[model samples]
Target: MARTLLIAGTASHVGKSTVAAGLCRHLADRGVAVAPFKAQNMSNNARAVPRATEPTEAGEIGVSQYVQARAARTEATTDMNPVLLKPRGDGESQLIIDGEAVENVGAGEYYEAGWERAREAARKAYSRLAAEYDVIIAEGAGSIAEINLADRDLANVETARFADADVFLLVDIERGGAFASLYGTLELMPEDLRDRVVGAAITKFRGDPSLLESGIVEIEERTGVPILGVLPYDDPGLPQEDSVSLPAAGETALYGDSSEVRIAVPRLSRISNFTDLEPLAREPGVGVAYGPPETVLEGADAVVLPGTKNTVDDLLELRTSGFGERLRTFSGPIVGLCGGYQMLGERITNAAVEGTGDEATVEGFGLLPVETHFSREKRVERVEREIRGVGPLAGALGRVTGYEIHMGETALTGPADRPFRDEGAATEQVFGTYLHGLFENRVAREAFLDRVFEYAGRMRPESHAEPSPYERAGALVADHLALDALGVSHENMSERV
Candidate 1:
């Protein structure tokens, strides 16, 4: 059996995912066989991993668990995150149980009838992971102290009970009221769950740690909890777990200003896997900005339509918002991914399958000579294919790996060049592909950047290698946190194993 450590947060977006990732890397560095688990996660950002029960089939898990698996130096599996709730607008969400899409249900229905099944699936998944790894670093969702939801909370309360895990509570000082939130959280948690907390750490502190000593000591005295450490504010540039990390719509967020070549990405209403643009943003001298459909193309050297949860709906919004008209007049390199690919086609049939409306067909932007048909069956699989090097990928020629998670089938309706064998359609300056994480490939990223810089008549800056995010995260945790107090040192290796 494996020992478990649950990383619980004070609230949503308080750096729980990052802290969990850091601990995963830190433990892996100490020769411990570790794995990441999130019993239930609600996020639109997801990645395809092999299903534990069906190894040959690809299944979906939240992106945070995927990143944590990488940080732990372990292969990602759907069992790492057994239940995922992808919100499809309104009050409903698509429930994924054991890496398969079960059904779409509203919050009330899920809690009333679906939660029991979800909990059972999560229990089995965690059991398998515990048997395989020496230590399981589990991440809690939202706040561990949601009193109203304590009984039904699978990610926090239920996990703490079933996994018999020690808890490390994380509070964000940047949000202000750090001590109050920490104290209140501990106070509100169920007695059994609260007793499981080994210690508390304040994260995202900007200034010196000494400034917080007096308050930390007082809080520890009042609550009978140890203040393990205060981590200085620093982002390791990991993939964001949800859209909460993204800038508000219509706001232009420029990553780097050194490069004159700007790649504009429209902030779709329900963007999914926007991590695809992170690679481009990481490139030197290149700038990737997310803005509204109307003005994102302004002064942009290239345009990228990102994947969305709802293709027909977002496409209709783009057209109504005048982005469709602006895109038609822009003479620059354009690329569409997944739902974005469907939007680039000539038409989409059976749109009712994925849309909220009753429409059976919807018109696409027609940038690519392709048509799409929606079906009840969604394609979710990891794929590797050769680049045909057409259109925006003119000079790129190599095998690239990515995953496809979508609800439609697309095919060419007219003569057009294929960008990735038969996977995507392309013209002279437009490209559309269902592949996610395309830019993660060096060849594809370089080729696309080269074309964008050329179109902007600017020099592409020399590339430089950066440190791995996992290594950075590990270093951050080791340098700041008191690993000894957490019983995560080399000396206790035998005991944990």
Candidate 2:
């Protein structure tokens, strides 16, 4: 059986995902066969991966696990994330077990009727992964000390028991209560699980590490736990795990200000797969901003309508807020992805399938000459499409790889240019596609940015190559973390063997 290390956080957004990912990369770089696991996750940001039981079929897993798999240098599989819960508002979430969609259930219903099944699925998945890998880095959700839900906390408490894992607690000093949070978390943790805590690490420190020397020593003496490391507050530009990372409504966040070109993204109430915009945001001169529907589209060189969990509801909200009209009048490059693509069409039929109302049909923004029809079946698959070089993607000719996870079908209602071989519709300045990671492709991204820069009458910034995020993360952990304390050798595994 593989050794398990549970990366549990003191609280939500305390850098658990990043710490897990960094450790995965660090171990993999030492030639250790490591795998990432998350028993359960609640996030709208999901990625399609191969199903464990049926390798030929596509299944969904949380984006953090998918990214961690990459960091570990292994193929992403549904076993990495056995159970996923995607929130859809109204105190309900769509439950997916073993990479397949089960149903939408409220919190009470899930705990009462679905919890056992989810736990069983997680157990089987973990067993499979343990049998294959030498080490499994498991990530916990939220706080490990949520005593109110301890019995049903699949990702943290239950994982600790079932996996017999050693826990590494992570505390975020940026939140301004590092010692108190760590002490409180250890105190509140179930006694059995608390004893499993091997060490604790404080993350997101801004200033000199020497300043925390006294506090770290005091905490260690009090809790009898070693302080593993104090990681600096540097982002390696990894994809965010959930909507909590997004800017709040009525707020605008701008990333990268060196360039005159700016692309505006309206923050959908239930935005999913917003990682598609990260690659563009990484560009030197280009700026990507997320704002509310009412004001985001104004004064932007280009616009990208991101994917949404509930398209019908978001479209209705946009129309009522007059965002649809603002979008129609703006004469810049406009692209919509997935649910956003559906919203760009003339109308959507069978809308009741994914909507809150009984309406059979709904009007789209009419940016594209296409119509969409909602269905019970959803498409979730990794795909590679040849760029047709139209609209925003003009002059970009090559294949781009991405995934599709949507609940509707779209067909053209009038003449329009095809953005991909036979998928998506486009005009001179408007484009729509079901492809989720479109901008990740260098050819496609450069092409789109070139168009946007031209429209804004600004020169495109020179591009520079950088290290891969996995490599950077590995270096970060290896340099700062005390691997010896965790029973991981600093020497390469291959060399030691």
Give the CA lDDT, 0 to 100, for residue 313 in model 1.
90
Models 1 onward score TM values of: 0.98, 0.98
The positional error of residue 160 in candidate 1, measured at the CA in angstroms, is 0.6
Worst-scoring 10-residue span by lDDT in model 1: 250-259
Candidate lDDT scores, in order, read 0.90, 0.91
Please report how far candidate 2 places residue 27 from its true position, in Å. 1.3
- Put down candidate 2 lDDT per residue, 58-142, tens digits, no spaces: 9999999999999999999999999999999899999999889999999999999999999999999999999999889999999
Q: lDDT, candidate 2, residue 97?
A: 97
